[model samples]
Target: MSERPYVLLSCAASIDGYIDDNTDERLLLSNDEDFDRVDEVRASCDAIMVGANTIRRDNPRLLVRAQQRREDRVNRGLPETPIKVTFTSRGDLDPQAQFFAAGDIEKIVFCASSAVDKCRDRLSGVATVVDAGNPVDLTAVLAELAARGSDD
Candidate 1:
């Protein structure tokens, strides 16, 4: 079998191990320097993934933000940003969310088998909705992503 893509899990949390607090607004867990570092990491990746809840709550653009970095990627024959990916059991994602709306690159949604049609219907123009098994098998999802050439 072909090798699966390398998975790099990146996150920021408070000293108490909380990524966020109970608030309507999203918490700022990282400073500007930290954000710049993450942007560099994102630039090096083949795809960037977030949970559906993050899309709902944080509404992040999930793009490599620096203009020069974007140009560099394009000059390398890559997209301005990497593919955007998300997984959900409920498939309750907003097509208008920045995850879907911001990038010119591909957007992929891996949903529970039961939610596939719903996600496909809801995210038709926004993302490529995939059935990642009934409970959303993460291993299979990663294999599929590797097959699609997201090796980083």
Candidate 2:
């Protein structure tokens, strides 16, 4: 594994600084080239991250489906799927959402202690929610993931 920061920051936004529109709708303004680029980045990194709102609205699978990304992951030995991560302070995640279902590998949902009770159940299939204790520290969450042998 390469020595890299535990947190890998990334986001998909419109050309107008909005992840979505004004109606709780999901908007993906990223072009095919941009999507390919994101796939490549995800292929190289250890984890792909987003906020809770991003996950709830978009329900992203966060996996690279393009041929190039798969080939790149093959070259890097990074696994066919990137670690899907979410930062939710209250653990207010819906486990039945497509975001959880679409993963080829396990999904990690990071929440605070207050959210653990909420996270402990309802999340099934190939995903698990992790309680990071009080205050929902993503820094600590990333550190823990890093310690678990993630490359970046």
Candidate 3:
């Protein structure tokens, strides 16, 4: 069996353990320094995964903002940015979201088995949706990522 990928769980939450409130605008959880640090971390990763809700709510580009960091990644024989990954249970994702629109690298969506077809039809050219078992098996996801050489 292929080894599971080394998962790095990164998030910015409040002291109250809230990542955001019910506001339409995203909460500012990090400062310039923190963002720079996060960018460095991102540059070192082979892929970055976030929940489907984060994509819908935040609409983040998920790109390495520093040109030097992106260039460094290229110099190391990597893509300009890491592969973008997202998980979904309902497959209710917007194809036009920045997650799909911004990056030239591969985009993967792990969906509940029940929603795989819907997600595939909806995402089509934008992303490759995999059936992540009924409850969406994270271990399997990591294994698949590892098999794809995204274990870092």
Clashing pairs in 3: none
Judged by TM-score, which candidate is best? Answer: 1
Residue 77 error, candidate 3, Å: 0.3
- The residue-by-residue lDDT of candidate 1 on 33-95, one tens digit each, is 999999999999899989999999989999999999999999999998999999999999999
* TM-score-better candidate, 1 vs 2: 1
Q: What is the C-alpha lDDT of each candidate?
A: 0.93, 0.72, 0.93
Per-residue lDDT for 52-99 in model 2, tens only? 887787777777777777777778676777777776776777776767
lDDT of 3 by residue, 56-131 (tens): 9889999999999999999999999999999999999999999999979999999999999989999999998999
Name the runs in model 3 displaced over 4 angstroms.
Answer: 15-17
- State TM-scores per candidate: 0.95, 0.81, 0.94
Q: Candidate 2 has what TM-score? A: 0.81
